[model samples]
Structures are given as structure tokens and as C-alpha cells.
Target chain A: GDSVTQTEGLVTLTKGLPVMLNCTYQTTYSPFLFWYVQHLNEAPKLLLKSSTDNKRTEHQGFYATLHKSSSSFHLQKSSVQLSDSALYFCALSPSNMGYKLTFGTGTSLLVDP
Target chain B: GALVYQYPRRTICKSGTSMRMECQAVGFQATSVAWYRQSPQKTFELIALSTVNSAIKYEQNFTQEKFPISHPNLSFSSMTVLNAYLEDRGLYLCGARRTGVQDTQYFGPGTRLLVL
Candidate 1:
């Protein structure tokens, strides 16, 4: 079975500071990893995704690099803004599983001004 | 670009009642749709996968009789939660994928279910 793990349950940061949300996963074969952000009362939107190993993908000022050797795809941002606060999820598309996703217990990011 | 829409953004049902939620995909072909439940504790659990012209696949602990899904076309789907209870209360999200590509699943504003 495939699974995703986010080490932090909540991460609070002051505006303009750096942001890092840890994500790790376990799978039997090659996997597709994704980061989804959900604002209060909103649907989850994709932030970034990667399947290739050791390649960094960026979107909306956020970036993540998939490290297959370490089985990690940690989301990072150089500078955080107040609007960046949201519930972030790390998910895995299981190998050979058709369109099914396994998600982690989300990390609530709080950006304080 | 692709977009997913869910009907009845929020619904409240009495215990043991049944409720059905709809999912529609626009701007792209939704070859497959996956249903997930985001519990109050906020864990996204895959309930089932419905593909056009194929049998719906439900995950462990989820059954067709309990969460029956229908994918009659490429762009529309619906799922009925039978005999709803407090434990079934959560945000039910429908994620549709274009061209059966599992890499990206565009999610819709979920149907929030409240069982009482």
C-alpha cells in the first residue's frame, strides 16, 4: 500500500519569512507526488507536482523537488505572504493505481503579519 | 484548463437518510473521476474511482452499496451516500482527470455533508 506523511501538523510563520513544509512518501514503485493548497472554505488547488527524481518544480512562487532516493518532496517558498496561509496537503498517486490518490494529514500554514 | 463543479455545496441529512451529490467537469474530458472524503479531522480518503464504461472501484472499507457512484458520461458523475450517519459527515470531493492521466486530479468545491 502507498502512503503519504507530513511531519508537521501546523506551521506558523511571520510574513516575509521563508516557508518549508515537509512531505515524505512510501510506495512500492515509481510515484507521482503532489502538493495541494486549500484556503478556508475553498476547494483544494494544486500547488506543485513531480514524478521525476531530483527535479525541482515551481508554481505560484512555491517550489518542490522530488528526491526519490530520500522519498521526499518538501514544499518551499523563499518568502511567505499573509495570503499564503492555508491547509496544505501532500499526496501520492500510487504506482499502477488508476487515478487514485493517497493523502497525508494536512499541515495548516498560518502566516502572521 | 479544466474545471470541476459539484452541486449542493452543502447538505444536511437526517440519520439513515440518503443523499446524492453531483460532479460535473467542464473545459476538458474527464476520463476518470475519483471520489474522496475529507473528514472533519481533515484526512483525504479515497472512497472510489469511477471510469467511463468500467466498473467502479471502491477502496477498502468503502463499498458500492454504501457509496454508489455513477459515471454515465465523460464529464458528469454522481454519488449517493446511503443510510448516512454521523460518521459519514465530511466534505465529499470529486476529482476528475483529463485523458485518464493520474498525475493531476482537478478537485471541485466539495459537497459538505452534515449528518444529524
Candidate 2:
């Protein structure tokens, strides 16, 4: 079975500090990886995705490199803002599976001003 | 641009009852719709995947008899939770994907279900 794993359940940092959220997956087939961010009481929004290994996909100030060799797509940002506080999810879809998503238990990030 | 809308943003059902949530896709055709449940303090668990003109596929813990799905058209789909109970209470989300594009899954503001 294909699955995604986010090692951090909660991450706290101060504004202007660098932050990184770890994500790794397991799949027998090539998988499309996605990063989603959800604010309080809001729907999860697509942050970034990549299927090409070693390519860094970025959106809105968040960037992640999908490393096929390591099966990792860790999300990173140079400087965190208060608005970055939210729940982040790492999802996987085996390319042949018609884009069905298997999400990891989200990591809740809190950036204080 | 793609947007998915879910009806009845929030609802409460009595234990042993049932409720249905609807998903509508706007802007682009939704060739496939997948339903997910986010349990309290937990991650999103896939309930089922419904592709237009194809049979719905349910995960191991989910059954069509328990969570009936109707994906009659390209843009609209509905899922009903039968015999709602404490374990069934959570946020139900519907993700829509275009026919040719098999990468992005646009999600709707999920329906929050409460069992009383």
C-alpha cells in the first residue's frame, strides 16, 4: 500500500526564522507528491507538487524538492511569517492510480510574531 | 481555474441516522471525484473514488453499502453516510480532478459533520 509520512506533528517558530517540515513517502510506483496548507477553519489549499525527482517545485514562498532517491519532499521556507501558521499536509498519488491522494497526518505550524 | 463547492457547510445528524453531502465543480469538468474524511486530530482518510462512467472504488475500511456515492455527471457528485455514529463524525471533503489532468486534486471547503 502507498503511504505518506510527515514526521513532525507540530512545529513552532518565531517570525523571520527559517522552517522546514519533513515529508517522506513509500510507493512501488512513481508517485506525484503534493504539499497542502490549511488555515484554521478553512479548506486545504494546494501549495506545491512535483513528480520529477531532484526538481524543486515552489509556490507562494514555499519550496520543496522531490527526491526520488530518498522518497522525500520536505517543505521549506527561508523566513517564516505569522501568517504561515497553519496545518500542512503531505499527500501522495501513485501516478497510475488516477490521482487519488493519500495524506499524512498533518503538521501544525505556529509562527509567532 | 478550478473550484469545488460543497453544500450545507455544516450539519448534525442523530446517531443511527444518515446524511448526504454534495460536491459541485465549477470552471472545469470534474471527471473524477474523491471523498475523504478528516477525523478529529487525525489525517484525511480516503472514503472512496468515483470516476464518471466508471464504478466507485472504496478503500478497505470503507464500503459502498456504508457510504453510498453517486457520480452521475461530470461536475456533480454526492455521498451519503449511512448510520452515522461517533466514529463517523468528521469533516467530509470532496476533491475534483479534470479528465486529462491527473495531477492536481482541487478540494472543496469540506462539510463538517457532527453526530449527536
Candidate 3:
């Protein structure tokens, strides 16, 4: 079985500040990690995903590096925007079972002016 | 660009009733469609995985009798929730993927189910 852990339940920060959302996963097989953002009343959108170890994947100003050694793929943004506030979920999909995604509890990010 | 559309953005049904939701894929072939439920204040849970020409696989705690899924073609899928109750209320999302393309799955807006 595969599992993803997002340690932070809620992260509040001011605009223009750097932000990091912790994400760690556990799996016996090769892992493919993903970061999904879901705004209020909207479907979850893919923000970043990666399968290659140590390779950083970036999309929409968000970046994450898959570190297989530590089983982490923390999402980071250089400058947080007011619109960046949303619920972020870290998911893990074993390479062998790519269609089944195990999601974390999700972290609600609140950005203030 | 690939897109997934879900029918009936929101619905309300009485306890013990049943409702069926549909998932459609556009601009690509959805060889695999996965159904997920996001309970209130909770993360998403995988209910079942439907692949073309293959049997549907239901996850633990979810049975085909309770959630019957049909993937008759590559572009469409439907699932019916039988005997819905208060605990079954949630946002049901369908994630469709083209198996040969990549592992990334695009999700639909989801059908919000409310049980009274």
C-alpha cells in the first residue's frame, strides 16, 4: 500500500512571502508524486508532478523536486499571491499502479494581504 | 487539451434513493476512468477504477453493489450510487486518463450529492 503525508493542516502567510508545503510519501515500489490545488467550489487542478528522482517539476510558479532518497516532494513558491490560497493535496501513485492515487489529508493555504 | 465533464453539477436525493452520475472525456480518449469521492472536510478517496475492455476494480470499503460503474466506451463512464444515505453525501469526481499518453489524470468539476 502507498501513502502520502501532508504534515501541515493549515498554513497562513502574508502576500509576497515565500511558502513551502511539506509532502512526504511511503511506498515499496517506484513512486510518482503529484501536487493538486483545489480552490473553493472548484475541482482539483494538477499543479506539479514528477516521477524522476531529484528532478524538479514546475508549473504555474509552483515547483517540487522529487527526492526518492528521503521520500519527499515538497511544494514551494517563491512569492505567494493572494490567489494562491487553496487546499493543497499531495498524492502518491506507485509506478506499477499508476491509475490508483493515494491522497493526503490536504493543507489549506491562506494568504493575506 | 484534454477535458473531463461531469453531468449534474449538483443533486439532492432522499435517503434510500439512487442517483447516477456520468463522466465524459473530450479531445482525447479516456482509456481509464477512476471514480473518487471527497467527503465534507476530508480528502478524496478512490472508489473504483474502470478501464476499457477490463473489469472495474473497487477499493476497500466500496463494493460494486453499492457503486456500480459502467465504462462502455473509451470516452464515457457512468456510476450509480445505490441506496444512498446521509453518509454517502459528498462530491463525486471522475478522473479520466489516456493510458498511452502519460500518468497525469485530468479531473472533472464533480457532482455534489446531497442526501436528505
lDDT of 1 by residue, A21-80 (tens): 999999997888989999987889988988888988999999999999999999999999
Candidate 1, lDDT over the whole model: 0.92
Q: What is candidate 1's CAPRI-style docking category based on DockQ?
A: medium
TM-scores for all predictions: 0.96, 0.96, 0.96
lDDT of 2 by residue, A1-113 (tens): 99999999999999999999999999998888999999987778899988888988889899999999999999999999999999999999888444589999999999988
Candidate 3 lDDT over residue span B59-103, tens digit each:
999999999999999999999999999999999999998758668
Tell me which of candidates 1 and 3 scores higher on lDDT. Answer: 3
Q: Which residues of candidate 1, in runs, are more than 4 Å off? A: A96-98, B100-102
Each model's C-alpha lDDT? 0.92, 0.92, 0.93
Per-model tally of clashing residue pairs = 0, 0, 0
Question: Model 2 chain A: which ten-residue window has the lowest total lDDT?
Answer: A93-102
**How displaced is residue B20 in candidate 3, in Å?**
0.7
By lDDT, who's the top model here? Answer: 3
Q: After superposition, how far is residue A68 of candidate 3 from its true place, in Å?
A: 1.7
Tens-digit per-residue lDDT, B1-116, candidate 2: 88899987999999999999999999999889999999998899999999999989999899999999999999999999999999999999999988688778889989999999
Candidate 1 chain B, run of 10 with poorest lDDT: B97-106
- What shift in Å separates residue B76 of candidate 1 from its native position after superposition? 0.6
